[model samples]
Target: MPIRLTILIVAGSALAGCSWAPPVQESRTGQIITAPANPSGVQRGPHGETSPVLLTARKMIGVDYAYGGHSPETGFDCSGLVYYAHKVNGIQVPRTAAAQFRFADPVPRDALRPGDLMFFRTSGRKISHVGIYLGPGRFVHAPGTGKHVTVADHRSTYWRARFAGAGRVKTNYPLRTSAVRNPR
Candidate 1:
């Protein structure tokens, strides 16, 4: 064999061996890649497993509602619940309900999806109340002082009339990690 051709072959083999491989898994925000054991144990809402965001919100149900409270141990206010819900999922959102509404992208009612923020006018003012969409026309929220966090239907007369708008918090997380480049 020619000396030049042999050197070229050896260099090519060395380069191939040195090639860098991507991670086996990739991490992302808002990716619902796992199927959580249905707490209700009953199939409800959209089929398949729930998104991590919604699951986080569901876990907070029954937490007490405290005025201006933001901690789970101390209870949660309307916006506080919103903050906690997204915070647990690694999404940073505005603290106040009104600010959250303004900060997030507007999502139409028809296009509403789980984990989206739903705004309302509880005090007859614009964007006064907020809740997390729980799919199947239901939402989870801290209604008011003395009340515990609860899930209610979106079509209820109170919410229906007071409905202001809805917003979506976007994240970079992939939907599935099994096929993800890097799990972390």
Candidate 2:
């Protein structure tokens, strides 16, 4: 039966010391299957989820919005959520929406992956809002004054009209090396 063949293949691979290879899955027909390598090259979690930065943002959902706030206890603004999330994950980013937009590396809308920053010009002529992209045209952010942190659809009329652009944070910063004192 197909089940026996699948078992044999798995056992044979195990006996052949192939345990060091990437994990495999079982198909509907009981066949062993391995996932194809990622083409977009975005770093994902063990379950193929977004990076920790986005995870941090996701945890902030339902948090009350507070202008110029920084943490969950103190509440959060759009940029405050982004800043706190990145900082918690050992990544440093600017504290305001405009500054964060200018600091990030520009990414094309079509190529956006999870964890990319989504900028929006909600008011005036400048980038005034930011969110953490969660893939599939969805993102998480702390929407204005009376709103709490929440996920949003970029395809919606309100957001789509104000959609500014996307950007990625540079995660690689030089590590500080302690200077050795000279004993003269």
Candidate 3:
């Protein structure tokens, strides 16, 4: 019964229509299921798991770490991993943890969703580390020098204590008509 309901939700969620309407789908048993945020496509992460951005991060697992590196071939540092994933998705996240923290709108812990960026103050009182939130208290990150990309518990003692905050980035920046020059 649960499997049937799950299948119904997975199929119905794809056709979420109407802007003013909440993405609420009904199950075979008349249960209500909320639509996922940004149900656009698999470009954000792990399909049937989380956002496609996270799927991209998951694909980077076991990639070697390199200081200031930003590609799979050269390996990646913490922020570099974020940069590579987001940049590939057409999101312009800065190449440093602090800057990346400032790249998106603030998101409270209770509101975190897949594709949100998790920031941490691992060293001191400033943002020093980052990871891609994959929901369910899990995230993907490039840990540090000599380490490989891996998934970590976002709510664990180590990460929870240092948790600075999280944010949701806009893949498409809004265009300002004023920024466009009149050819006239």
Best by TM-score: 2
lDDT accuracy of residue 65 in candidate 1:
88
When sorted by TM-score, best at the front, the candidate numbers are 2, 1, 3
Top candidate (lDDT): 2
List, residue by residue over 80-173, the lDDT tens digit for candidate 1. 9888877777877778887887777788898887778899988757578889887767898999988987788889898899898888777674
Between candidates 2 and 3, the one scoring higher on lDDT is 2
Tell me the spans in candidate 3 whose CA falls farther than 4 Å from its real position: 1-50, 174-184
Residue 178's lDDT within candidate 2 is 26
- lDDT of model number 1: 0.71
User: How many residue pairs clash (N, CA or C atoms closer than 3 angstroms) in each of the candidate models, in the order given?
Assistant: 8, 0, 8
Better of 1 and 2 by TM-score: 2
lDDT of each: 0.71, 0.78, 0.73
